[model samples]
Target: MEGLYIEPTETSPKVHFDPEAFSFEISGESRPEDVRKFYKPVLDWFEQYSNYLYWLTEKYAEGEKKLVQFHFVFEYFNSSSAKYIMDVIAKLGDIQKASPNAKIQILWHYDEPDEDMKEAGEEFETITNIPFKYIINPD
Candidate 1:
């Protein structure tokens, strides 16, 4: 599959989901007035990607986990966006559970000056079934 790429807007983040590379990334700020409308395509892409990987793992690559590496680098986001983020992670968890040779690693990025962002990542880790890596970036 090609991938879903969305340019960053003032109230939303940039999304890049590459199914071929098995990598996905969302960065920038997210606080869309209508969160559902903004994130529906993203959630849909995740679902399709999950199904594709599930098929690939079953038919082609057997014994290979770690099917995806997802990166989340948000400079800022509203409470509503937080809820959507959790849903995205949950979708990934579901994908992992459904595919026997499926694994996902989430990397949460935050700059040194943003302790709140760092804390947000830490808090999300506690609630998610997927493994996460907290990255302290100076950017």
Candidate 2:
């Protein structure tokens, strides 16, 4: 399937969802005017890709890794954006639950000395079963 690549704007984050490579990433800031509208396509695309993944595994091969590496690098986001983020995470969790090979590694990137950002990542780790890798920016 073709991938999704949305450029970042003043209010939205950069998005890259590549099912061919089995990866997804969202970076930059996310405080769009309509959070649901902005993220709806993302959810839609993921649902389609997830169905493909399940079909591929069930028909041809079983136990193949459905590892979708997801990166979330947010410099800043509003409280409203948090709800959308959780939606993405929950969808990922559903993908994981549907397939044993569906393991998602979420890498949360924050600037150095940004304890709040780190804490946010930790909070996500507690909220979902998706494994998280917290990364501190070098710059």
Cα-based TM-score, every candidate: 0.90, 0.89
C-alpha lDDT values of all predictions: 0.85, 0.83
lDDT of 2 by residue, 1-139 (tens): 8899999999999998887776678999899999999999999887887777777665535566755678899989889998888888888888776666666678899998889988888887788766788888888
Which residue pairs show collisions in model 1? none
* Residue-level lDDT tens digits of model 1 in 8-100: 999999998888776689999999999999999989888887778888777646575654678999999999999899888888888878777
All candidates: CA RMSD (Å): 1.7, 1.8
Deviation from native of the Cα of residue 77 in model 1, angstroms? 0.4
Error of 1 at 39 (Å): 0.8
Can you tell me which runs of candidate 1 are displaced by over 4 Å?
60-63
